[model samples]
Target: MSKILVTGANGQLGQCIKELSVSLDPDNTYLFKSSKDLDITNYQQVLAAFTLENFDFCINCAAYTNVDKAESDTQNAVNVNSTGAQNLATACNQTNTTLLHISTDFVFDGTKNSPYIETDKTAALSVYGNTKNVGETEIIKKAPKSYIIRTSWLYSEYGHNFMKTMIRFGSEKDSLSVINDQTGTPTYAKDLAEVLIKIIQNKPIPYGIYHYSNEGTATWFDFAKAIFEITKSTIQLHPIATEAYPLPAKRPKYSVLNSSKIKTALQLEIPAWRDSLKKAINALP
Candidate 1:
């Protein structure tokens, strides 16, 4: 049995890992720790956790996820997203454990007007994006036997994500304005978590960055509309340009990531964006 340690047990992706672990294998060797138990940013804490657990693999799901809020709090974002990841990578290196890290599509600037390939150059548009890039770099530089999977537009039943926000607003408001300028793929955290598990179980994960999300592209407006449609909510979604609705942070206009690398490399089947959305919505309360 491979001893596995999962960081960020409280977050969406981490919680999904925990939930999936229950059915995947009750006897599976795994330890789930929330940040309150082991703050990844602290090198001593990370080292102590790894020394105690001596895990064969470490799946890092903790992150600073506030997009707009990251603009005002850049240091905290960098600390958690970048430095915390670095600490984990260092600990993984010292512990001789494989790392499976989660990353965002925001690492790219979305200037290509197309789905970004793994080989494509990355240019972050927002503070969150920049710091995530730093974290990705940290993993690449520090961990040799690591799998960095970059996904976008993630939402899950447990977290405060786009789908949950839309659901609440749809029930409360008659109409909502969503930006149409930016485009990306909607990745269900559950789906992502399963993919990570499969990668760990099936093959020796090659050390590099790979992109995966549910197939298809849609703007925020399209995503919000899909949410309302699936929920049978009567919220009118008004599509507007990004300029018309500014936020504290500047997101990429088109940050869709290409998953052909993962599909062909891992021989994995990717679910459609709408199909995953339907499942997520149905699973919701």
Candidate 2:
């Protein structure tokens, strides 16, 4: 029985993992820790935790996710995303633990017209993206046994996310305008949680960078519309270009990831974005 350590246990993805862990292999023991319990930025704390638990695998779900706020809080973002990642990787390497790190599609500049593959050159456009890219690089350099999985537009029933935001806004507002130009897949956090567990359970672990998101593509407008449709809300929705709505951080125009590598490696079929959205909505209280 392998011991699994999950960081950022209170976050959406980590919470999803905890929820689904009941159905996981009974032989495996899981330890879920939030930032309060284990601060990844402090190398000593990370090393101590690993030393105490003797974990076989560490799933890093901790990240600085505020895309817009990262513009002003660059230092905090870099500290958590880059330095924290390096600390965890170093700890994992020292303890001989395989690290499964979560990454973002924002690492790309979104200039490509085609779906992004794992090998594509990264040119992050936002502070959050740049920091996350640095985190990925740090993990790759520090931890030899690491699986860096980049996902896009993550949302779940738990925590603050786009789906929950839209649901709340749709209920309160008579009408709303959403950006239709930015395109990517909405990855359900529960779906991602399950896949992460499967990777550890499966043999001949594929230790490398890979992409994982619910299949298919949609803009923020399409995503919001789908949410309203699923809830049977009559909120008026308008589609607008990226320029219609501006934020501190610049989002990718097209960040759809090609998940073929992960699918083939795991021999699994991913659920469609719409299907997963429905599941997430139904799961909500």
Question: Judged by lDDT, which candidate is best?
Answer: 2
TM-score of 1: 0.98
Q: Give me the displacement of residue 28 in model 1, in angstroms.
A: 2.4
lDDT of 1 by residue, 1-285 (tens): 788899998999998899897887566687888989889889999999899877999999889999999999999999999999999999999889999999899998888987899989988999999999999999999998888999999998987899999999999999999999899999999999888888777757567989999999999999999999888999778999999997898888888899998898879889999999999988886
List ranges where model 1 is wrong by over 4 Å: none
Q: What is the C-alpha RMSD of each candidate to the true structure, in Å?
A: 1.0, 0.7
lDDT of 1: 0.90
- Residue 276 lDDT (model 1): 95
Global lDDT of each candidate: 0.90, 0.94
Q: Write the per-residue lDDT of candidate 2 for residues 86-155, one digit (tens) a residue.
A: 9999999999999999999999999998899999999999999999999999999999999999999999
TM-score for each prediction? 0.98, 0.99
Q: Which of the numbered candidates is closest to the native, going by highest TM-score?
A: 2
